[model samples]
Target: MSEKNRQGKRTARERLAEEREKQKSAEKRRRVLIVGASVVCVLGLAAVIGVVAANVGKDDGSESAGPVVVPSGAKGKDSLAIPVGKESAKSTLTVWEDFRCPACKAFETAYRPVIHELTNSGQLKVDYHLATIIDGNMGGTGSRTAANAAACAQDAGKFTAYHDVLFDNQPEETDDAFAENSKVIELAAKVDGLDTPAFRTCVEKGTHNSWVDKSAAAFRNGGFTGTPTVILDGKNIYQDQTMTPAKLKQLVQEAAKG
Candidate 1:
């Protein structure tokens, strides 16, 4: 065959090799984009949240009883105690998660039914420590914005619902991830007793900005270097490659058995 004719066809193995190379390149670019976006989001908005929070002097309507002290189980670890769910369970489960983290989303979805069963039966209470892990993964303010929005829903006792919506309607991580205003409203509307005027006011001026920053500070100060970290009944569990949610639930159950 002529040189040009010979080049016209390739074996299946050769084609497969080419496709694998393309996939590897795509994964590399994706990793870089996620890191760059997260840094920009945190550096820009975290500062803004600090400034806004300082100006409020505690009038932001998110006043908790006092500064949450890390429990003995999660001692020397990074964590926060936000009363998520019904706040009335034999044992409490605290999670530090980024709204935009896919693993976080998966856990949220996977554990929903169990949570409902636990909360309804008064077996478990869950607290979410919202961390901005994705600000470094996705290149935008989506993580920060989503964190603040969660706080806003939290005010109305609707965080669980809003939490689900955020992960459900999540856009691909990019500069545009945080620009969709309508999605915020859609999530907010689902929150029961979420006053439109008050919620709108909070969202408009980003009232919940402080909560996001404060949570991030807690994560850093508490020594957590990653998102989706859990403090179950006071023991910190930094998941390794072998970790699974079933094992986590087993841990929770065992802790509660005591």
Candidate 2:
């Protein structure tokens, strides 16, 4: 081969190697940039989550900071449960409920009759724990206010009747009607002897607001996902799709026999 041709071939091979090295460098830089951007995105998301968590903590603290005026004759841990039947009843139904929750209202509507019958017959007792989750989610005080009024009724020795009246006249979840003390007092007129001055004062002043907040905190801390969490004799009957008022009555009757 001619010397000039050999020299030209060597130069061409050197140029090709240089070109490949440039491409490799460019690819490495591109990968680094992509990783950096991904890290930045992750950090940004974490910061946002932190801010949201802090805000939630602050709100919860503010809501829960007050005197917890438990209702008269309240039962259970922290006196957060309103009892509705003879203590000697064979079965106890634990109900975690929210006043402004539509599902809770539905459950009450469907089960109220059977529950009343069972309680009246001294076969079953119910421990009602009130939560204000709807107030937290929907941005209102109706749930807490209504709960306070119910507590006042408990003090008046008319909790069951007032509770039924409240459920029967529950406003829409989005409607803050129950937030108005007058509205709750108006509903109290439906319950005999529940519209007295002390009841009105308790309702207006939100005497049990802190207690209600504590109950809501308990509902959340208990790992419950939603309202109307109905547990019959330690079994969560509400989670069973086949559960009905008749089934509930049958369960209570069986418990009574045992």
lDDT of each prediction vs. the true structure? 0.60, 0.81
In candidate 2, the residue pairs with backbone N, CA or C atoms under 3 Å apart (3 or more residues apart, or in different chains) clash, namely none
The TM-score obtained by model 2 is 0.76
TM-scores, each model vs. reference: 0.61, 0.76
User: lDDT tens digits, residues 10-112, model 2?
Assistant: 9999999999999999999999999876544422233422322332322223256468899999988888899999999999999987777766766777789
Error of 1 at 136 (Å): 3.3
Model 1 ranges off by over 4 Å:
1-80, 85-88, 192-195, 238-258
Ten consecutive residues with minimal summed lDDT in candidate 2? 51-60
- Give each model's clash number: 7, 0
Off by over 4 Å in 2: 1-62
- Name the 10 consecutive residues with the lowest summed lDDT in model 1: 52-61
Instruction: Write one digit per residue (lDDT tens) for candidate 1, span 155-193.
Output: 656767777778777665444464344567666766667
